[model samples]
Target: MPADAAAWHAWQAHQHQQRQRAAAQAAAARPSWTRRLRPAPPAPVRAATLVAALVAGLAFALLLGDGMGPGLALAALPAMAAAFTAARAAHRKARPWTLAWVAGCAALLVIPALRDSAWPSTLAILCTALLGALALHGSRTWPGVLLSPLGFADAAVSGIGWAWSGLHAVGRGSKERWLPVAKAAAVAVGLLLLFGTLFSSADAAFADLLGDLMPDISLVDGPLRIVLFLFGALVALTAARAAAAPLRWDRIEVAPGTPRSRIEWALPLILLNLLFAGFNAVQLAVLFGGYDKVLKSTHLTYAEYARQGFWQLLWATLLTLAVIALALRWAPRGKPGDRRFVRVVLGVLCALTLVVVASALRRMDLYVDAYGLTQLRVSVAAMELWLGLVIVLIVAAGVFGARWLPRAVVGSAAGAVLVFGLLSPDGMVAERNVARFEETGKIDLAYFQSLSADAVPALDRLPEPKRSCALRGINDELSAAGDTPWYATSLGEYRAREILRERPVTAPYEVCSRLGSFGSRIEY
Candidate 1:
């Protein structure tokens, strides 16, 4: 019994020592009291750190917004780099494609700065928004492509969430970091003001120097700048966070599709194909017969016949693209017959659409030939040509290509726009109008005068009276403008000013004098 009692005591003692040792080790490994008292940083606090860095970028972009040139291009870099980095950090798995997407977006945004064309800039802004959607969903289907605008909207919402979350995190830790910084800033400012006042009172020279150095800060302007800073910072931060944490569009539930029989799908497609074929047949006759047949059939003049069909055909082409996209999405793809029917019908529709596009182009050419070429007409013509290219791509992809069709479509559209931008639409409009006037002996001096500086070189090619009138008209219009900042001054306007300075001023001719100024104020 005595031995047993001793053994039990030893066992109990060993267990006590083991518990003591564990408690000691755990206590040693535990965090300090200061850390324990501190609030846990929020998940979105990292986004706050990112936003702080982006504030500097936003300021630089704002500063550079004054001019469109290398400055604008340089301004785009900070936002581009920030977005790319944030996206990578948020989604490491989405690295490869994200890099390409961001790079493409950056290039598109920079083109307008380099080329100084409105169309490219508009396209670039659109492409950038689309890329933001692409970054989030990582899909290239109809839902992804079509819902890009929605995705942008969702990103804005998500960004607000992130910013609020970040602010919460910052609030919780304000005592730790923010208070110190605020206190230091306050002390520094107070000291500067106190010393500044003392020096001003002590020495008139110092006061004069100080007064000269310190700009007159307008109360209204100062507040406006502050407001702008906050606005810009919020926007930049929101975009950064949203890019890092993209909203998934696939989460939105869609209704399950009811499958249709092959006949149900084939009949409509067949009817549509027939309608398109009939239109194409008529178009062929009209195109082959020239504007004469169009005038005869419509019982109208060449301009009326051409003008009426151009807009209608453009709408038809756009509607056809949408229809094809929908058909591809919901049409029966499970059965061989259905697939074959879709492929054939869509292919034929695309081919016929190409014919329509060609007819439209022919009509636009006739109209431009009769009337003078304007920016709208030229842009529309370019679009018509692009539509034809899209149709050809659709036909080729449907027939021969199997994969990457969406990418091909996107690339082709982008390529077309890039080519058009490089072509310089303003210059083309000027050249074509000048050439037409030269041949037809009908020149609208007012129209030529209204053209931007891109048309200057082309306008300079005209004969003496026309050249002098055109230059004078443009110079008069440009010179009468109200004061504008350097950033607001476009490349076209700058070049036009240069042209005006370089060329000699010519007195108004009888023709130039007879036509009164189109603008309201007759400063001339």
Candidate 2:
């Protein structure tokens, strides 16, 4: 940021000249082709063609039989009202693509709580909206300013709502551009939906035979729509600000005097996936178990939902922000060889990815065994790092990689990690099998519920390298033996030992995968 502006300018100029030469070469190759197909599509035809596309997209969305059930299609009342709102119409590109978006929402509409089936239909709804948005904005018939926002909400109900906005704004012709790399998420979502539909069908059969290993699939609810709107507002705001600031095309064409700010790229990359993952995680959390793990024992109420909402925002915000910072620093950018402090970041990222996966597996642990903060924190810390790294790589690699952006970032990330781990605190991976033997500690059983069964013997067989807070609490219970003093005495230990001796170690992996407990301890 501080130095090497002159070097950047030289590098940028060279890159721009090369780009011009390539364009010239390609144009020369296609001289006759250019005559047959105008280099730029006409604005009117672009608009009118979209009118037909809107019709097709709407028709496709309506035919989607799963996410939007035939019976509940009428439930799209609120959305239809919003889409057709006078305010919305006045603002969006007055093109047919706008109507197509509304129609997609209308066709893909589902009842609020009746999740129905959300695979291909939802995917279709999303895809159609995206295509319509792309078609509208690409043909100069209209600008994205008036419509991208409502179109976001209207499109989001199908999932990938934010991305649909980005894609439409980016324009279809710019397939070689970096922005649509964001839309790969929409593509991924679509693929997931298609596969998910098959997976669910097979899973249903499997459930009948194997007993529902997977949670029943569910659709995003209305409350989620509200949250998405808020999230979309944030994304739109960020993008709008970026767009409004006139792109010093000169600066971009030639990397600025400042090394291309990776944050310019990294923040959007990390944020997009973070938003998607969090949204889906929330969906899984709510639909699978009815949001009970977050609920206190007394009752299920709006207060509980409200309380959970607070924590969700708190956690998502903290984690998402942390992810952004990590990407900005560790992920690669600029000339192919510029491997700065990347390894340090990768070491941190690898460790964190494992943690996220574990946290996900252990969500079930919380529900069944009352798992607490230690597990949650460790899990999220790991997850945030991993997600931040992966998303950054994929987006840059996929979008910017047109010029090898992804490869440079990834190769450097791996190389940096390998070199750093050997030189410093980072390593490929430290298998603690033996050192684990050296570091032992007393821990509360609740903390171990989600831990592997082998861990029990390991703990019992090792010394107290660290005193677990849970163990301390359990010890406190045993320590005080006054008439009503709280402590786990020999009696408590004896009882616990007996319980442990009789209890089977293995737990259902299904239960381990939910939002709460990983498998702290199984109670039959």
Candidate 3:
């Protein structure tokens, strides 16, 4: 009997050794990239992640049902918290730049709570999402900056796998441990329902209080709420996974283009510079020589000349950026003289492009002065300004080393967006138009009608019927919106409601009709 038992133990030890060898062979057979991928998190972390995702989902379903407002910030809180928790659990340190990007995302999310303008709100939401992705898996390289959003796809796949594995684990031994707790919860729920129903039936006020506390889930809203819940859970899970194990986008190598001779690089750029100089000279002449000289030379009105060339100049400036990029790619890199030559030529091109940027902006300014300010005009102008800033940063990068250029450019863009939101662009448009109207006795009432609640204060400054007429659309919207919930409240909407309540639009239709074409002009 002792000899038989010894044989059985030896056989079991041999089997365990064979299983370990097979596992090692399987691991070795994996592709290099697959081997580099992060392993699944520990069981405790997985359980925590699942709980966090469910909480985030619940927050989203509750807070995000309303329009864009403070509720967006509230809904995003759980996901951000889960990301931080997962990162900490995985022993990943948050870099300073990543933290800054996260802070910027938080600030951008708050913009929608402050302003009701469609453009700013939309931009804020979009920028926040991009920034959030960058916070998770940001790279300092230009390629990485451009490709960081791809992490979302990776995270989604990883998150789904993580969830499936986690659920399977829970179904194994975890069920037995949780069974008693589940039973206890079921009993507690039963008791609460019985007692709550009896109390509610006994007191009218208690029933009203209970009704007010509970969410009104209708048949149509039920599916939508479920969808929102699922979406939020997915987002939280993906974000946590991304924070724990960020994709190494910078590791994807890009080979440099073949270096070119100095003549091949310098000649075309010199000619481009001359062309730019000639155009800039004409622009300068038109700028300093006034509208009379433009009329004499082009036989066109100031506004017409400004309008005709601004779009073309804008395109030229954008193309110049592309040209500079390509030129740098093929730039000579052999000698000291070659480096200097590259810098001088590309610097000249960038300088000339700056002139073009200035010309485009000047033309836009002249056009805006001629006509009233619109959302399109303001948006284009802001874009032009940002592009010019990019060119300036390129020049700086050329002078200094370009190691920081990619991240700097991205940071500038985010800063520009933040500044744009803080400035309240819709308010700026309204104020500018109002000032123009006061100066020239011309106003585009139809444009004013399209402005959001952010423009209310400026529109309130208008005289008599024009003011009421300008505010009628916004007022009607606010009236129809009825009462806003606290979570869904926005500063712009609240202020507009208050202003309208104090001084409602009085006989807007009659006044607007009496003014006829003078009140609102059709924009061509």
Separately for all candidates shown, the number of backbone clashes (residues 3 or more apart, or on different chains) is 2, 32, 0
Off by over 4 Å in 2: 1-128, 131-340, 368-524
Task: Quote model 1's TM-score.
Answer: 0.72
Model 3, global lDDT = 0.80
Q: How many residue pairs in model 2 have overlapping backbones?
A: 32
Poorest lDDT segment (10 consecutive residues) of candidate 3: 36-45
After superposing candidate 3, which stretches have Cα over 4 Å from the reference?
Answer: 1-44, 170-220, 514-524
Most accurate candidate by lDDT: 3
Query: Candidate 3 residues 255-320, lDDT tens each?
Result: 889999978878888998999999989888777888787787788887888899888988898898
What is the full ranking by TM-score, best candidate first? 3, 1, 2
List the candidate numbers ranked by lDDT, top first.
3, 1, 2
Clashes of 3: 0
Error of 2 at 55 (Å): 5.9
Q: TM-scores, in order shown?
A: 0.72, 0.25, 0.86
Give the worst 10-residue stretch by lDDT in candidate 2.
424-433
